[model samples]
Target: MTESVQAWFFLLLAFVGGVSAAAFSFRLLGYLAVSLRRPRDLRRRYGAWAVVTGPTSGIGRSVALKLARKGLNLVLLDLSAANLQETSDMIRSRHGVKTRTVVFDLSLVGTPQGDDSMRRLRAAIDGLDVGVLVNNAGVARPSVAYLHEADVELWVRMLKVNLWALTEVTAAVLPGMVERGRGAVLNMGSASSEAIPSFPLNTIYASTKRYVAKFSRSLYVEYRNKGIDVQCQVTHNQPISRPAFKFHQQE
Candidate 1:
């Protein structure tokens, strides 16, 4: 009986080790494949124009600049007109590519005015050969607080901006991608989506981010064969409090 128990333990240990090694190897290969892709590959696989929501600041701005550098023309969307214009100008100057800006608040997604804004957004991209859509606009409460302590208004705003806006924008853009038979949609997610460590004091924010991951994964599976690549980029780091370059001139 003792010998049999020892054999079973060793077998279990070996199986776990093998699984871990295989997971690591697969991840390494995936990273290597992504690293090997060039800017031209993006243009060829996706298209020429890339749309970035929340392009005025933070990670959205960074993504917009990188895509511009890769020879993609830009359609920038944000709430601040001045900031959107500044981002558009910078992309044109640095990358020598064309850029168009659309300024609209995402927090009012279900309102009549929001519908008009969506119509405008669709109109703006109508004739363009858009290749990539980055649904990066989102909001969080100003500070962390327990569920009952959190501001009710902020919670509603977070849901609109983080969840509703993402779905609306993707719906508007995805049909075009499907018709064209080639495009990419990148949804920004948070590390909290994994929920392994259990985030505290920010329940609403974490839940919304978790929704983004599940939504993106579902879309990816649905459209993988239709030449649409959907990805949820899970970020672990917090946004920079101060950006190095001010993309917009202060009003």
Candidate 2:
């Protein structure tokens, strides 16, 4: 433990931590700027309609509102029919934009009910020009636990929503976007998914989001020539953390 060696070690650690902090800060500031400036003009660039899943609350609600403000008609989906109608009506009243609501639970995406919901979802978006798809529906564990101690069924439901539902929605939306020859898909990811060193307490959840990131990147490359822009946004509850390693995942 010589003084010079210790000095170099501390410097190296600081460099790594600073880089992570810088990335977090950059993403936070960029998001705020985009939200405030509303400079993208998504409707003009994409098409007349956008479909946003889980639109009843949280990030989904915010995204739906912003898209409406940008002058894009909306197709809002959520598990609760009541919530769906509430959000839809609010958006329509506030923005004076057309809104359609569909109640579909992403966690039950493999059952008969889910199949029916899928068909209904397809019918809902059939003829319109869906220029943007926001895969914002998601779920997470109610309580933190190690993998071995986790409840199996709960984890399975999370997977169905996070992976299966998002994938199916993307698949359904892509054909129309391809035919129109222009669109964008935004898949939501979490900070737990390799956005940090690791998410040890939330192992399975992190892995699913990592899959989202990988799936999005591959799709971006696959469809870029086809006029499709697919992007995965990794988010943290706090845009900035005090200690630089407290980035927590959002549901």
Candidate 3:
């Protein structure tokens, strides 16, 4: 082969490698920045109170604790009243931050029971300065059956809980934030949606998370000028080296 051909081949290879490296570097730095930022910034910029859903376990519980440590009062929501009480007590005891619990079941979106829960939630935060909202309550079908294998009811229930519930809860808190003109809204998204080429068995879950990403982007554009910072955190259940505070709109 001619030297000119060899030179062009190496140049193309170098260009591709450089682009890939830069993309990865930016992603790593993004994670590092989120892990390093002080949590107190949320309270200082937004308000004194924050609301977190599904605070009884997992990432929700972690986020609740982090916000509490930042000296923000917490409103905890979960399906189990006992679990909510337990988490609320722990937060209060550990951080000495005021904590309130509301039994919230995101799955019952269209039912009387869910409506009652919404009413209670509204009452709980009535007339309070709620500035940070973490919409973390989500559910995935327990089994890994293919879409056709599962009953239609199962997918419908997942939709209600994962997508509709988050939207309803956000709408509930967002107006209050708008009136106050300063707030931060964080939505829990999934890595299966945009990060991967395909998610075989978890189709509905991935679709709902894609919805979350789009919803968050629209909210960011609509409300950023109004002093609201909307962020969608695309996360995976797999372990990671850094904290899961990574957000789409932060950088």
- Residue by residue across 151-240, what tens digits does model 2's lDDT show? 889999989998999999899889999999989888887777755878887877888888888898788878888888776776644321
Q: Give the Cα-based TM-score of candidate 2 against the true structure.
A: 0.80
TM-scores, all models, native as reference: 0.83, 0.80, 0.86
lDDT of 3: 0.82
Relative to the unseen true structure, what is the Cα RMSD of model 1? 6.5
On TM-score, the candidate that comes out on top is 3
**Candidate achieving higher TM-score, 1 or 3:** 3
lDDT of 1 by residue, 105-163 (tens): 99988999899889889999998889899888889774479888878888999999999
- Clash pairs detected, candidate 3: none
Off by over 4 Å in 2: 1-38, 236-251
lDDT of 2: 0.82
lDDT of 3 by residue, 129-151 (tens): 99999988887784477888888
Candidate 3 off by > 4 Å = 17-40, 236-251
Cα shift from native, residue 238, model 1 (Å): 17
Give one clash count per candidate, in the order shown.
Answer: 0, 0, 0
- Residue 172, candidate 1: alpha-carbon lDDT: 89
Query: Candidates 1 and 2: which is better by TM-score?
Result: 1
lDDT of 2 at 91: 95
Compute the lDDT for candidate 1.
0.81
